[model samples]
Target: MTATRPLLDPAAARRRYVRVCVLFWLPLGLTIAPLVLLLTQRGLGLAAVAGLTAVHSLTAAALELPTGGLSDVLGRRAVLAAAGLLNLAALTLLALGTTPWPLALGMALMGAGRALSSGPAEAWYVDTVQVHGGPGADLRTGLARGSSATSAALAAGTLLGGALPWLLRLGPDLGAATSGRVLPLSVPLLLGAAVYVAFVLHALTALPEPPRPPATLRGVLRGVPGTVLDGLRLGGRDAVVRRVLLSAAAAGGALAALELLTPGRAAALTGASESGAVLFAGLACAGFVCAGLGSHLAPLTARVAGSGERAVLLALGAGACGLLLLGAAPTATGRFSVLLAATGYGLVYLGLGAAGPNQNDALHHRVSGAVRATALSVQSLALQLAGALAGLAVGLLPPGRLPWLLGGAALLSAALLWCRRAGHLAPPDVSSPAEAVRPGVRTDAGEGQRLL
Candidate 1:
């Protein structure tokens, strides 16, 4: 006789949640400090980098829904394993390849891995929690913990990744001998690949997929398309989900604008290529730390503002102000102005971080487990699609005007979150009221569901 799986206890759920957060983010974070500088160091131009980024986003956008449905049908654990394998290949190519085409190929692989990984881990967490703790299980705290863990991992990995190249440079002979062609910059990506290897092994052993009908190729093909259609329909039928997705797209545009502009700005401020890379790395680390702080404070922000929608609006407003400050910094002449720009950078991450868990919490309440991963993938697709457009457009604009344009777009996004009348529309088409409203708690549609 086969042994039965145990129901997920609170302690077991917490361990899995933290595992998913660390494994998913740590590999990506390891590359953040060196990625752009490494490309430029390999003779890629600004336009080329923009093109590569757009390609990555487009690739991820194309695969998002299909991969989500694959996870929904096949299994989250299987899909996550595939993602890890792909990352191993992608990161190897990225670390070793020198030319643009080679790097582009690596980017393509990375995008596919990203799409596969996006929702499966989170879906697993939600499903496992609901199975043990019931549909009315408190998700905001768990989601926040996952979000904060991701940010914290990024912060620590970025700090370490940034400092490694500098330290390696100090011992030039040994560094060249060990790292070969790509030198200090490529070291982090190589290390990231090793992390992916470990991530795959850990995921295979640690995560237990919920039992479903046995998966067949025919089932996957038939089931996935139907799942995609249902997920798309859900977005159309629900006004809140539609608004949340649009807001995600706008946030994507803002993020693209920042990622494109900021490193170049850092390079200008520091006046040395190597020094700039290190400085940008440090700043990126600081930004991620600030983001973690924002996520940790999200529930408090919601409670204080009286609604998730209002909190989202307030956070976006802060982001817009930060962008405006960044835009203004160039006109001023002082080291203090540079410091102001840095502060603005941190603020943007803070605002974006605060908005994420709130938006996701709203989305989770509006949907059912049957299409959970697909729905999350739809949200991710919106972000990637807008980011692809923003990457191309932001690269074309003069640096001075970029932040203002992005800030305006963010302001418009915040406007969409405003609901004139706070009332219910019969709690959507969710399977149970507990799915939309937390157990015994009553919530208004416009204000969003209260999780805390």
Candidate 2:
């Protein structure tokens, strides 16, 4: 008789998840600081850059659900590896291409990669932990650690990405060899592509899942849409899930407003766009650091609040208060305004960071492993779509406290959604017979009914 491979313990699985999370996010971070500057250096105008960004957003939004469903049908390892490969190609094209078409294609590919990666890793982590520790696994600690790793990777990558070009210029003119086509700004993107190679390797080798039934093309085509439909129906059927989706949208809107308004505020304060850009970059790094700190503190927050539901409510309320403070910042006199704005900025990220793991822990408990990735994809899509709308509205609104106030109000309303006890919500229906009867599995029908 053939022996089966041993399943990983929850502790080992958590460490692996955190490592993969860092690897996955760090590459994207490496490109974030230098992408815009690289495009402009390659001769694209600001208008063109904006259009390309929109293309990325639209492509990701369009593909998010489909890719997530594909992950469900095809398995997490395959989809994640594919995403890494696509990102590698996208980064290469972005680094090398000077023309509009190549750049646009690169952005589209990047968006596709983003959609493909949205939820598989987290889903894999949850599934693995549950398999080892039963349905009552300590998911929040692992989730919090993963979140913290992501933020730390982004913060490190952003600083390294921003500093690489300047450091290169201090040494030698490497761009001369490529006749200025390979500008210093493009170096970060090239390095990002290299990172993706490692990411792909890690995904394929490290993330082993239980054997899925052999999937043919016809099977995949049929399965993906069904899974996607099931995920869409979840929000309508589950009250807790519905609330989570709404809260994600509100958070996205608040973030959109903050990102749209902050740079201009910084520029107005500094009297030069260039200096303001520098300050904004620094502030972005600080925000990520604050987010990491909050994520690290997530378990303690839950302990203090007495439950994950109350923790989310408190954290989001804090975020809403941060937005209100930002709105009030404009009214403050002199240097006090700067101090107030900075404090609010940190608070916004910190609150969001603390809320994310707790919110996701609730989500995982309420979802079956079969549709877990798809549910996460739905959450991501809600955030992206709401952010797009909020960005448009904030852009159109006249410069004042109205935009910030609106964001705060939306977040506050979302916070209030969690004010009621979890027992009041209806339990989610079981997704499948396999999930319902699986050994050591706790279906949402039992625990989800008790905890929101």
Candidate 3:
């Protein structure tokens, strides 16, 4: 039997890979996300959170294709730096805003940072690995490691967000508080800035840079429309791409719905008191920690399931079940039972996160650098679109309907996964059709022929 090739230069791949991974996740975890909506000024009402998320998602969607192209044209290092700056600005805005309009704007700006950061980090890692080593290789090591780092950051961030609100670490409540001790809103926000700064400094010092010529302002603007269209076309044509997009959309939708609704769900599930606050914080940390674990375990789970598509379906199914349990957890055993809800949320996220990058890696083997960015951009578009619509829908629903709304999103996510392009598997190497379906594939049908 032939031993498979290494994914990239394992050592450089490991170092640069870990750096980029942490850079992408650390600041993101500390700022602009779960805390912004869930533990916001009003205790994260469903409609309010959903509305803010929708706006944030829309901003992300707006930048998805553009940022992907920027990575291709400008190089990943620059994009990563830009992303960090955008995040710092966004966190500042989010922290300062008390009302909806400013909050929405803050969310939107944060989403732009999210959009710019998304594909570039992985693309850089993959490109670095290829230059140092060879091609058509095993990517799971780097991918899994990166994912593990991200999960770690997320786990840490979840704990921080939960405790930061209640901690009396700050000097005094300038604005005043109900209790003698006070945790100002600026504390978490500033912490987020600190994390972003750390990530930026790390990136500059640790990661390797390659040659990249800058593009003119006119050239960049002209390329945007074509970039968006071409990416959509490429993704649409590829079987693996199709399945990845669906899986990503489903996962994105489910995640958006869960984050938007869960704070209120926890508040309602647990009574509103100091003890209740502790419980809610504990549950929030538990949910994210479990989610991170699910992300780390995704490769194994996908292997068992036989493909990314099936894995996504399984994850979405788990999420759907969790939503139901969360919705009904008002009984004697109800509060204890909602742990299942957190578990399902994590599993679904795992599926979504794993599928897209794996599929993009495969497609990169087929396409050249110029177009590769576009293909990945298309994947970003699909995920963002799904999240945006789901966020809007959840916000539009009446205040108390979040659980059902989340359940509906989970079902929709399942539907999208089930509709994956299952016929495109070509059984690379010696793998069987059954195996291909588990991993999912595109039969040169998309690119007309697989390239050397």
Candidate 4:
């Protein structure tokens, strides 16, 4: 038998993983602040923009499972590289495309890239850690650090992305030169594309996995569907997994309410759409900064709460309170209302950031490495689907506190899921060093190995 290659030391692996996380997320941050503004500048109406955003969400939701399965079957590095290439194309199209069709196509491609990239990097990190330190490895610290890096990247990108166009407009003829074919707003997207190139290179070179049996095309085609199905069934089979999925959906609903309604509130406060956009961008940047701080504090949160489950419960409860505060913001008048809104927004993000690492750490303890990426995809899918539903519902409701209240209610319910502990929440044994270290090996034989 061929000897298995030794894995990187845990500390070295973690540093590389954190670096990759920043690279993967920074480009996304660069585009987030300017994407809608750029699209509208190209003559797209609000409805058209909404349609385009829906296309991205639906495409990602549809592809999430299959792409995750592909990662499980093929490998993380290859899948991540593919996502980068697709995102590069997507960003290019968005930056330069003038017509609705091209832009729509770009959105679809971006969604596909989002789905493909979602889980693989985190899965790779967890697998590497467990292989080095056993199934009981200290995963929260690394996970929290990665989450912090992601938020920091996003915060920096949002500031840079929002400022680049304004800076371009200041120079004589600079706006005319860049804004004629490619608007100054599109510069961020172009920069994001360049970043994707770096992301692709780094993903290829930096993330190394243990050798697997050479996969034939037929094997991959056959394996992916099975893996996806197994992932889907995981929620039903495991109590802890079900709780995680449900909580993800609830969190999604809360976030959807915020994203859908917050801009209008900002506009209401500022009394102008343009200024509102600027204010929203600043708020968004601040939110990310708060989230990064929260993520950095996650390990400490877990330590204080006594268990991952308790930490998640407390964190999500805080998020629910934030949403409620937002719901109450409109009831106040003048600067007080703005203050309420801002505080609530920061709290919501902070709580969510803190909750995420603890929740995932609990999740990682329950599932095997073989299906790790697929599991994360399922969690993401739940969030996307629930957010879509929540957006629709919030849109139909009478304006004011109702929408925010609905989100607050959803988050509170999710937080309540962890109020009581179950026996199944305990971590499974993988004390055998070889078994714990083996990537892609099925650990749930008694549950039926036939699934693999």
- C-alpha lDDT of all candidate models, in order: 0.76, 0.85, 0.60, 0.85
Q: Model 1 residue 293 lDDT?
A: 84
**Model 2 lDDT at residue 168:** 85
Candidate RMSDs in order? 3.9, 3.3, 7.3, 4.8
Residues 294-371 of candidate 1: C-alpha lDDT, one tens digit per residue: 888888887898877777777777777777778777744368978888888888888888878777777776666778
What's model 2's TM-score? 0.94
Most accurate candidate by TM-score? 2
TM-score of candidate 4 versus the correct structure, residues matched by position: 0.92
lDDT of 4: 0.85
- Tens-place lDDT per residue, model 2, 74-125, is 8888999999998899999999898999999999999999999999999888
List candidate 1 segments past 4 Å from native: 1-3, 39-51, 98-102, 172-182, 267-276, 398-402, 419-452
Flag regions of model 4 displaced more than 4 Å. 1-5, 172-179, 331-333, 423-452
For 203-280, candidate 4 gives per-residue lDDT tens digits of 888788876668999999998998898788878877677889999999999999999888888888898888988888
Q: Per-residue lDDT for 346 in model 2? A: 91
Listed in order, each prediction's TM-score against the native is 0.87, 0.94, 0.74, 0.92
Task: Give the Å error, residue 85, model 1.
Answer: 1.2
Q: How many clashes would you count in candidate 4?
A: 0
